[model samples]
Structures are given as structure tokens and as C-alpha cells.
Target: MSHSTAFASQADLAEKKTSFTQLSANAWAYTAEGDPNSGVIVGDDSVMVIDATATPVMAAALVRRIREVTDLPIRHVVLTHYHAVRVLGAAGFVPEGAVNVIASRATRDLIVERGAEDMASEIGRFPRLFQAQESIPGLTWPTLVFEKELTLHLGSLEVRLLHLGAGHTSGDSIAWIPSQGIVFSGDLVEFNAGVYTGDAHLAAWPDTLDRLAALQPQQLVPGRGPALRTPADSLSAIAYTRDWVQTLLQCARDGVAAGHTLQQVYADTRRVMDPVFGQVFIYEHCIPFDVSRAYDEARGIANPRIWTDVRDREMWAAIQS
Candidate 1:
């Protein structure tokens, strides 16, 4: 099979303007035109970074932003999930005083299971995102792991890291700050961007989303896109994400029930998804993987298969065929 569209992101070499928007006194969002975002929480004495960027060099940009506001050491790095784009930059924060790398127990498990493959896979897909790819040391390991929920005090500021449920990945976590009614939702929530459910638990995504909505955060820093500043916008982001997942799963289910081929399901899913989400950032890059996973889950595959550079190409070729 021939290559198709070059991953849709290989050509996305244009730089995106980065924004460091302050959501609250303690919370700031590091967003770039729909790229994965990182969250910053400043306490009285230390700082915490949520979702490190794709590479240490990329993470240095976040550190620059953090330093502009405070000289406090970055004491913690939280992994909302195990995606390489989000975790590989943990080491970048080490110099900034980040000692403890924290993640949910399940996220740590995923790193052990497929981290190396994912690291190579993601770097290939989005070359521009990994600015200085050579700077990456290896798969990021979480020094501190928690089960369902873990709460920490960054010098009196309370931050709750909760493993809400399976959605974007089996080990997705969200950082909630009750004091400011702010939450940092990793890839579990996206606004004005493609919701990549390439390794998602589609059937359980909605319910997990429900749990996030129950938090009623006043402001939310999603995994991508701009920060949601209003409670209304936060709800909209959750609703939009749910709609994306539900619509794709429904299309996959319909196609599978009709005994259609993967290519056929891809066409069917696009016919429905494109009209609404086509214009978003990375929509093209995400569609193939998202549709493939949706098809798998619809066919009763409970766990998402590990993605390798080879498997990614094979899957892409199959759908293109």
C-alpha cells in the first residue's frame, strides 16, 4: 500500500503562536494554536507543571513562561496521561527544580506497556511538535504514582489529581483546584480542535466526561485549544468532546453492524464527522487513527492496541487502500 497524506501533520510545519494565559492567580495555560497544552500552578513557595510538552526543548519554552511570573522552583510535574507528547518533557523541568514526576497508577502502567513504541510513533507523526527531538532522553517514568485520586498542597494551594475514568486513555487524569474552581483536563477535553480518540475507551468516555462535568469548574485548561474561562464554556468543551466521541462511535457501530470494511467505515465516519469537526486543528491528522480505534471498539475490542511506527503506517495504508 502507498503512503497517504503524509500523516496530515508532516506538512504542518508552520509555527503556531503560543499563548500563556492566566486563568486564575495560581493557574496559567500554555497553549499554542491547538497543540497539546501544559498547565502551570503557582503556590506560595513552589510551582507545578501539568502535562509537559513533547520535548525538553519545547518544555523550556514553558519554563520561560513560568519564570516570567515566579522564581519558585518547579517542584512537581503531573502526567495527565502517558502520551509521549505529554510526558517526554519531564526531564526539562528537572533543572527548574522539578523532582517528583507524578502520574496515576494506570498511566505509569501504560508507560511500561507501550511507552517506547508510542515515543517513536508520535515523533514520526508530528515532526514540528517535537521541535528538538534529539533532546528527548527516553520514555518518561513517573516517580510518584497514585491510584484513584491524590491530593497535594503546593505550599497551601490545594491541587487534586484525580483519575476520573477511562476516556482519552485508560489512565487519564485531571488536575482540579477547588480553591479557584479551575481544572486542567488533559486530552480528555478539547475545544476548537480534533479530539484524537486513537487509544480511547469510547464506550466509557461519556460517563467519564460526566464525572468531569460534575466538577463544575469555573475555568478549565483543556489538553488543547485556548483555556475555557467561564463555567458555561467549560461545559461546552465537555459537551463538544462527548459529541465528538459519541458521533464517531455511533458511526463505527453502524458501519460494523452493516459488516462494512475498515475503509468503508472510514468513509462513513468522515461523512458524519467532517462536516462538524473538519476545520479544527489536526482534524486530518486525527481522523484516520480515531476512526480506526472507533471501529475496533465497536467490534468489541475492549482495550486499545499498542501503536508502533510500523503499525501506524500499516493502519494508514489499509484505510487508504
Candidate 2:
């Protein structure tokens, strides 16, 4: 698909995709203004939540929504990845012991290592979701961890959790509800927003998207965009995310080959990708960090380095200035 068919421009696609829309019966998506989003699927006997919002307080609001719709218990909480904003609010979803919190093994390892640093970094990025910060007891740990793929029957409702290769993060997973014909694509496929590539695998992103597309989902709740209602729309969203990763990878390499500084590389990426992404949610919030990571990866840096408190502040100061 041509870039424009998927997007009028990056800005137009980002804005339209980031806005959330309801998908189907008992299914809902909570998206940002082009920021990260979570999904929910309520079953007959229990509820399966796609992701926990940024804080306990934010998660409480979702629980309230669930109560308003159905008294059925929330049976499982699925973490798409190990991002602090996505998994931290799990404490708010203390809906009973029956609920199985599931994540990839790598996600569990991430929680052990850099979850705290990421928590601080994201809190500073998104203040609205992290309201009642003290309400967050600590990082959320998955009760049930899996490797690769798992077929979970949440009561009569059949849900599929697949670790369909890494695109967003090393441990990225997607929640697929075949009964509803809907898939929660986590950050593996960003609808309209610029993919936050700090923890992303740019080279593998396309194939990951292809694996997700092969699922033949009729409705899709992308990690950051609106719910995709049509096949064409879904393809477009996935394609755009792939294009974004490729664009940044090429731009970073080009800048480095020309002996440019990190800032210079970022500027070059912006010049080309901006026309397509200038309007996405957190475009400004994400670009410097995204560029830095991409630059490092393009220059042969494997296994992303830890971002400590000092490193976070230093990057924030340098990038923001």
C-alpha cells in the first residue's frame, strides 16, 4: 500500500488513529491522544483485560466501567509488554484471586531489571494517567508467565495469547479473542502514532506485523490508535507502523554514515518522517528518545542499554533543550 492510502500524511493518520473507538459486544479500547492504549474483553463468566493503564487510579476507572457493564468477575489480566505504564496499574484490578495475570517470561525479567526506571520515565511523560501516584504500591508482577504461545479458555470464552515475535519490545505479546474476532495488537502494531521505538526491534517489526495480520482478525485494538473496524483499515495501520520503523532505521544510518551527531540524526529523521508523523500523539515526547535508540541499533548496538535515573535526566535535559 502506498503511504498515502494508509495515511493522508503521517500527521493525519496519527491523529485519526490515536483516537479510541468501541469495537464490538462487551469489548472496549482505551487509547490516548495518539498515546499508548489498552483493551478490554468481558466474557460470560469472567472478564479478560488486555492491559492495565498507567496507575492504580487509572485502572480503577476501568474497573468501574466493567462494573457498570457487567457484574461478571475479571478473570485474567494480560500484559502486552512490560512497559511500566501498561502493567503498573494491575494492583487496581484486584478483582479476586481467580484472575490470572499473564505475561511473557522476558517481560517478567524486564520487571526485575529496568521496570522501575521505565516507570519513572513514563510517569514524567504521561502525568494524567499516573494520577494518585501513591496509590501505585509497586511494579506489577505477572501471576502466570508463559513463553511463545498459550491458548487460554477464560471460562467459555476462548482467548489466545501469542508471543508473535518482538516488534515493540523483546517480550511483546498480543491478545487475540477469536470469539469476538478482535485482536489486541499491543505495541506490535501502532495505529496512527509514531511507534515508540525505545524498546523496539525495528528490523523485526514488519514480520511481527505480518504474523499479527495472518490472524485474520475482523476487529483490532491497536496499542496506540483507534479500533480498526475494517480489513483495509487494519492493513493500513500495520503498514504505517512498519513504514515508520524502516524510515527511522534508514534515516539513522544515513546520518551516521555522514558523520552526524545524535541531534543531527534526529533532525534528519524528523525532516523526512515528520511530514508523515509530525501530528501523532507524543510525537515530540517520543522522537528524541526514539531516534537515539534507532541510531544506536543502526550502529550495531544490540541489547538495549539500561536507562538509569541519571541517564534519564541527562537524556531529558539534552533532548528537551
| Lowest-sum lDDT 10-residue window in model 2 | 1-10
Count of backbone collisions in candidate 2: 3
In model 1, pairs of residues that clash are none
Candidate 1 vs. true structure, TM-score: 0.98
Output the number of the TM-score-best candidate.
1
Candidate 2 clashing pairs?
A: 10-276, 17-226, 75-99
Q: How accurate is candidate 2 locally (lDDT)?
A: 0.78
After superposition, candidate 1 runs with Cα above 4 Å error: 1-4
lDDT of 1 by residue, 67-149 (tens): 99999999999999999999998889988764789999999999999999999899888888898889999889999999999
Quote each prediction's TM-score: 0.98, 0.89
Model 2: per-residue lDDT, tens digit, 256-316?
8998888778767888988888877656656767887888888888767666556755765
